[model samples]
Every structure is written in structure tokens, then in C-alpha cells.
Target: MSFVHFSVLKDECLQFLTENAPSNSYFADLTFGGGGHSFAIMDLDESYKLVGVDQDPDALKNGAKLIAEKQLGERVELLSSNFSKFPKLIKEKDPEIEFQGILMDLGVSSHQFDIPERGFSFKYDAPLDMRMNYEDDTIETAADICNTRDADELEEIFKTYGEERFARRIAEKIVEERPIASTKDLENIIFHCYPRNMRFGKIHPATRCFQALRIAVNEELGVLTEVLPQLVELLKTGGRLVVISFHSLEDRIVKRAFKELGGKDSPFRILTKKPVTPSKNEIAANSRSRSAKLRVIERI
Candidate 1:
């Protein structure tokens, strides 16, 4: 069966990774969403070994099939774990292997958002589950956050992660209407929280709330911040690290991390001073690709 995926920025990512490869050096695709970048880079060069990491078990399962089908068994290694744990795992896998190219395409996959049962999309009437790993039984969920978190705490989540200006009012309304049990119910609460006149903005009113919940449910930003410096350290000198972020909050994290690592006195040099967005052609083909911002830096 064909994997349910259309890789974003295929040509662009391939160009950056391949061009920066250290004379056929090893590479790591940290997010490895669809194995598109891993497959492309592995296929482009014979000496390029690959490690593909993902938190979701199902994604790695699909990746296994994709790797075998592509006849990349000799070149690629798949890991079923969070990329935040990547440094320790990399050393565990093979002490001799050091990555020359690392790519992190952050944010939820198309598969996650498209499948209603996963409860990623607010427009879809799915269950409230948003766990990246079905096996990870710990951590608070969107439902728990909505129902259990105080109004002040919930408001801060919306403001920080979602950049929602009406965050405080939304949290107040959510507190009044407790136990938001479904995606639609949560969306409705956010929709009505805003006055009718103010609600009809360019994007849906619930957009930020959903994003905030997903980040919290997954602890995405925290994981990212923890791992950023580690990834820079793991890179070989002159090695390239590419990060693609889909939202402004994510972009900000990536931007700050890249800047700190790329400092002249630091271990790396900046490659993309400004983040790169998708071309008009790519954006036209995939609407979700529009918001993506790609940034790269090289270990000095």
C-alpha cells in the first residue's frame, strides 16, 4: 500500500542536505515524517548512511515498508522514539557513526491531521486523543488540560503556543463550560468566546487553541528547546542542521536556537539568515506547506 504522504519541500530539502553532505558522509533525519528526505538523501549518494527517528510507532512502521520498497535496507536505520532522545540513542546505535547532516521537519504530519480518529483536526469530530505515541501512557492530554487546568494556566498556553490575543477570554469561557469532551465541542467554545464581529477574521478563532492543545498534549516546544543544543553538539564540524517549522511559535524557537548556535564565538555559522518558505508552486500544491519556514546552520 502506498504511504499516505506527500513530502513538503522535497526538492528544496534534498538540495540543501545533499549539497552540504561531507563527501558522502552519514546523515540523520531527526523527524523523518514520511521518510521522504531520508530516502532522497540516501538515494542520492552511495556513501551516505542514514538514521531516521520518529516518536510515533505507526510512522516508523510505515517507514520500514517504505525503506524496504525503496531497497534502502543497507543504508537506513529506523528508530521508534522521540528525537529529543536522539543524542543518547545515536551513541548507542553506533559510536563510530557521526552525522554530517541533520534535518528536523517539525509539526504534525499530514497523516495526523487528515485522520479524524487521531483527533488532531478541530474541524473533524474525532476522539480527544492527540498522543504522538500510543504507547506513551503518561502526560496530560487536551481533555485534561481543558477540564483540569485553571483559567490562568490555560490562557498562558494559548498565548504562548498559539499566539492567540483573545486567550484570556477564551480560557474564561472554557472554564464556564467544563469538560470539553470532543474536538467540535472545544472548537465551538472557542468560536462563541469571541464576539461575532471579531470572530470573522482570516483564520478560524479556534486555530490557536487547537495548536496550543496539540503542543501541550505532546510537550512539543519543551522537547524542542531541550534538544536544540544537543543536536548542535551532535553535529560534526561543518555539518549542517536544517529545521522546518510550521507555526510562528515553532519558527521563533528554531530561529533563536539557530542564532545562538550560529554565533561567531559559538560552534556554528548561520546559513539562512532569513527563514525560507515554500515556493509558490509548492504552496499551490499543498496548502499546509504554506506556513512552513526552513532554516539551516553549519557547525563551525
Candidate 2:
């Protein structure tokens, strides 16, 4: 499948990040899934340069091809690394390099969700593997967590990460049905755990469980927590750090970190008092973007 992702809050991000930008400035797109935001920034000014980073090998390959196809090799540099490691990697490459803008569009890419083999969405009946970098065998797969984690651990993951009301019941059911190796297998287990009336509810019973498994498998929250502070420090004075989170957990972290960094003694100021949500038109065009919340903080 082709790499496709709608850059959430594209206009809002560009407006804030490039409002007072100078010539020959640098920017970073930490989660350059489809190069949507990165390419847009480059298109805004010929002197602007972008460092696009992504851990997914597929994204790196696609980004490289797109850069070459667009003949943007001189302006866009693609890196293969998780967003969490971008600060260290950039420092090693050029300690003096500071970005005018940095963006992180968190959560699984649309490509990842559409590809059934990747197992990110419950709609697919593939292996229950949700690692962002599937090539990294060291990372635990969703199947591993479902099959090995105790009911208590599973319950916590469902409750903390997914906020599922039936976390305990679902966790117990997962434990009862061991060796859940496929998405459908796990989905069935979760579906049966829900009340009969809710089986056909607006939301799928497997949605929260799948989300919880993906979060645990990828350590998404922990990575986000560790990267926010580092990203803020990498920004130049007046530079902006823009983060678009798809879930409340990720949004809360971004909100709290921005608030802490924007304290009176701190060197940052919150740009968006409240997060920017998708317009009704955008949400209607792309339902997946309905939950996206964009937050910005500027170094002072």
C-alpha cells in the first residue's frame, strides 16, 4: 500500500511555526509519516530546510524517494530513527543546529493502520503485531503481551492506556483465552467480554483493547514523555514545538509538559491556551482526524 497520512492541522501548524521565521531557517518533522507537513514547510520557502525523522523503515524509504522525485535532496534530509532519539541524533550530527520549528504528529500512521499485515487496526485479521518498527525484534509484539501478561497487568494497560470501562472483565477474558496470536482472536475475546447489548454499539468492543495493546507494545506514552523536554531544548529562541496527539493520554502529557516549560522562570510560552481541534469539514473528510489535538509552545 502507498504511504498516505493527512497532516492534522496543517494550516494551523504552518501558520504558527512559520509566522516570524527568518531566511535560511531549519525545521524538524519528528514523525514524518508521509512527509505531508515536512514537504509543506519546504514548499513555503526555498531557503527553508527540513530534517525529517521516522523509525519506520518504510517511511524512510518513501521519504527518500519523494525527496528525490521532488529534487528536494538539497533541502530535505531524511533520518531513520524514532522521534525520541531525534534530539541526540541531531546533536551528534550538528551540535549547533537549532530548529525554527519542530513538529510531532503522534500515533500510528494512516499507512500503518491501512496495511492489514501491520496489525495496527482491529479491522484486520492479521497477526497481533503493533510495533512501530516491526524490524526491531527486541521490541515486544502485541501477541506477546496478550499471551504472557497477567490479568492484573492487562487490566492496568486497558484502564490506564485505553480507559476502557470493562478493563478487568476484558483482561480476565484475555487470560482465560490464552495464545491469542491474531487480531481477530483478540478481538473475539474482547467482544465476548462486553455485555450482549454493547456488542453492536457505536464503538467496537475491541477498539480500546487494541489501542491498549498497541500502546504497551510500542511504549508510546513513555517515549512521548521523554522526548518533549529534549525537543523544547533543541528549539532556538522564538522557535516553536508543535505536537498533535490523537488521544487524551498523549494530549495530557503534551499539555502538562508545555505548562511546566512555560512557567514564569522557564524559557517557553504556551502558544495555544487550549489545543486546536480539527474543523468539522476536516473531520468529515477524514474521520481519523476527529480526535487530533494540536498544541504549540515557543521558546523565549
Candidate 3:
């Protein structure tokens, strides 16, 4: 399978990262999907070096191939690990490695959703296995979550992560229909949970429910909360951290974290008071880029 991820807000990320970076600076691409941003950053300067990290095995394999094909072998180093553990990984790889810039593009990649077996999209009829790192046995699959979690927990996930208005109703329905075998099964439950009139809205009825399940299974918010501070610490003075989040929950976390860390007496400064979103042209080109919100902070 071809790893085809359109890096959201690509140029904006590069602008922020490279603007204040010194010559020969080192950077990290924490979610190195398709090696898109990593290669773009490397193209900016021959002296610069990048460490590309991704938890997905497919991404790691494709990234290695991309690096080799681009002849970026000497400049880009690809690591197969979750971005949450990036701090420890960097420490072991190079004790003195402090980044001039770090980037995180959160949410599922296009490749993941397009693959039927990944079960990220309702459009596919695959098993409910929405693990970002499917190889990790410890993390529960989406089906496991639906089948095992209580109604209250499911409601909380839908409300907090997905922000679905009818969270309680949806959760109750899911619990009532236990052993959801496939994406279609879950989709049907959510679709019926919506009112007949509201079911034919601009978005699919299953969108929020699926998003909630994926978030819960991955523990995305908790991981992001833990990793944000570490990224700031990994930066050198004047270094920048650029995060692009696709949903409101993620943007809120990034916003709050930046505010907390960018205050007086703190070592960081928020660069964007409001998040930067994708332009009309980018959105037209890749519709998936539409919901992207980018925030940047610099170590002062």
C-alpha cells in the first residue's frame, strides 16, 4: 500500500520552523507520515538535519524508502516509535540532541483510513481495529472498546473527545447492541441514533462516534498532554514547536498547554495567538486539510 498523506498546512509549518532556526540546525518531525514535511524541511537547507518518528510500522517502512529515494540518507534519520516516547528515544540516540524545531501533525493519516483493514473510516467495512499502532498488543482495538467499555465511559468518550451532542443516546445504543463486529455495524447504530431529519446532515452520522472510539482506543488526548511539555523541554533556546491538530479536542489541549507554558517566568512564548488554518487553495487541493489548525511556540 502506498503511504499517501497530504501534509496539512505544509508550507506554514516550514515557515515557522525554519524562520528562526540557525544554520545547520536539527529538527524533529514527530508524526512523520509519508515523510512529506520531513522532506520539505530538508529541502530548505543542506546543512539541516531531521529526525523523523512515527509509531505506525507502515509509515516507518515507507519513510525509509522515501528517504533513500530522495537521497536524504545522510540528512534524515527515521525512527519507529510513538511521538509520546520521543524524549526518551532522542536521549538514547544522542544525549546532546536538542532540536531547533519540532513538529507534530496529529490525527489519522489518509493512508490509514484508505486501507480497509485499518478500520479508521466508516466508508470501509473492515473489522473495528482503529489502533494507530496496530502492532502494539497492549492498546485495545475499537471493537474491544465498544464491546467492553461501559455505557458511562463510552458516553464520556463521545462527549469529551468527539463532542457529539447525543452522546448518551449513542452510548446507550452501542451498549445495547453489544459485539459490534465491523465498521458497518457500528455505523448503523450511530446513524439510527440520530433523528431521521438530522441523519441527512452535512456530515455522516457515524463521524463523531468513530472519532470518539479512535481517540479512546489511542488515548490521544492524554498522550498529547504528556508529550507537549516534553517537546518544549527538548527544544534549544529560541527553538520552536509546531503542532497541527485536526479536531477541536486536540486544538484545545494544544492551546491550553501553550498558554500554561508561555507565561511570564516560563521558558516558552506563544507565537500564534490564534491557530493558523489551511488556506482555501490547500483545502481545495486536499479536502482532508480543511479542519487543520496549527499552533506554534518558541523557547525563549
Candidate 4:
């Protein structure tokens, strides 16, 4: 398809970022998957400077096209690195350039899912390679995890990340059918593990299991736990932090982090008590956004 992909919760995220962002402020697009949100923020204020981060090689290539297309090279900085490392880079780029807005559209992008080679979707049969950073050798692929991790660890991953009710049974079946090498391989395994009647439920029986594997292989939640607070601290005083999470686990982490960062004694004031979700139209257009929750907090 096209390199064009929409960002989830775009309106709410841009509004939160713009409302509190100071004139001539610096902004960081942490999950700069397709640069949709970054371009939106740049549209708001020409004076605002943006630093976009993404480890995905394809996203960086797309970022170049976006920046050039918008003639934003003068106002934008692109970093081909994990967003978790941005704090150090900011300190280096401008020891004094404290950012006024930080937007993290967490989880895999539509671009990732649409690319079958990346193996993020159950719809396609592809290699179980789900690394956002294809260059990172440290990350274990989904197939590797499926074939290698012990039954208990697999169960724990499914429980912690996927929250699957049949985590134990799934793990047992996965171990029983070792050497699973592709999305179809794992999906078929999950299919056989659950009863035939229950397989055709509301959602695919393999959805949660695949999600758990993807999260585990990518170390997604672990990175989020470390990244969110640093994103908060990286913001200038009165700066805004807008995050769009794709699942309950991520939303819970964002919700808890924002609440802890701001109270009577903390350094932030919550802009949104509850998360902002996509509109009906947006959800209809992009099914990936149905679970998105946007939450914002401002540093005090």
C-alpha cells in the first residue's frame, strides 16, 4: 500500500501539545512512526521546532519524505534511535533546549502491521520478525521466543502482556509444538490449543498470544516503564506530555505514571482525568485506533 498512514487520536494529541506549548518552543515526537503527528504539530506553529525519533528504518525513510514534502527540514530534526535514549541526545543537541511538548504514540504503527515481512499481523503469513529496530540484534524474534522460552516464561508473557485467560494452555501447546517459525505457525498452534467451538469467538483466538509474543520480542512494556517518566522530566516546566497508548497494559502504565507525577506534591497537573479516545469516524476509518487512549500531563 501507500507509505501514508494515519496517527491515532490525532486531534486530541495535537490539541494537548499545542495548548500548553510555548511560542518558539521545542517539541519531541517520540514515536515518530509516520510523522503524521509531528507534521500536525508543525502546522500549528511554524516557530515550534521538532525532534522526531524512531528506530524503524522505514519510518525514518518516510520521515525524510514528510520533512522534505512539507519543507520542514529547517524546523525539524530526525533521530534514528530509540525514543528511550532521547533524554541524553536532547542534553547534547542543546544543553539548554528543554522541550515544551513531548508526544509518544505508543505501540506498533499501522505501517508495521501492513508490512507483512515485519510479521505483526495475524492476517498475513510471514516470518515472525517483529523488531521495530531491524538493526537491533539484542531483540529476539517472535519465532525465537516461541521455540526457545520455557513454558512458564511463555505463560508469564501471555499473562502479563496479553492477559489471555488461557495463558497456561497456550504456553503448553506452544512448547509442545516447538520450532514454530512463522505467524501462521503460531496462529495455527493457538487455533489447535483452544477448543474448536471457542476458536471462532469475538476476536481471533490467536490475537492475544501473538500480541504477547510481539510485546515480548520487542521488549515494549519494559521500554515504556523507563521512557514515560523520562519524557515527563525532559519537558520544560509547564510543558505538555501527550501519549497515545494502544492497549490496556500500556494505558494503565501511562495512567499510573501521569497520576504519580502530579498531585498536590508532584510536578505535574493532569490535563485529562480520563483518557481521550478516537471519534466514531476515526475508529471506523482505522480499526487499529479502536483501543487507543490519549492521556496528557503538564509539568509544573
lDDT (CA) for every model shown?
A: 0.84, 0.92, 0.92, 0.87
Off by over 4 Å in 1: 20-24
Q: Candidate 4, residues 1-300: lDDT per residue as tens digits?
A: 357577888888877888866779889998898888989889998899999999999999888987998899999989998887888887887777777889889888888988889899878999988888887888788888888989999999999999888899989988998888888988888888888889899999999988888889878888888878877878888889888888999898888988888878887899898888889999899887898888888988
Better of 2 and 4 by lDDT: 2
For all predicted structures, in order, the TM-scores are 0.94, 0.98, 0.97, 0.96
lDDT tens digits, residue span 1-300, model 2: 478888888999999889999999899999999999999999999999999999888888899999999999999998888888889989998999899999999998899999998988889889999988999999999999988989999999999999999999988988998888899998888899899999999999989888988999989999999989999999999999999999999999999989888999888999899999999999999899999999999999
Q: By TM-score, is 1 or 3 better?
A: 3
Query: Per-prediction RMSD in angstroms?
Result: 1.7, 0.9, 1.1, 1.4
**TM-score of structure candidate 2:** 0.98
lDDT, model 1: 0.84
Worst 10 residues of 1 by lDDT: 1-10
Better of 1 and 2 by TM-score: 2
Put down candidate 3 lDDT per residue, 1-300, tens digits, no spaces. Answer: 688888899899999999988889999999998888988999999999999988988999999988888898999998888788989978997888899999999988999989999999999899999998999999899999889989999999899888899999989999999889899999999999999999989999899889988998888999999999888989999999999999988999999999999999988999999999999999999999999999999998
Residue 108's lDDT in candidate 4: 84
Candidate 4 global CA lDDT score: 0.87
Off by over 4 Å in 3: none
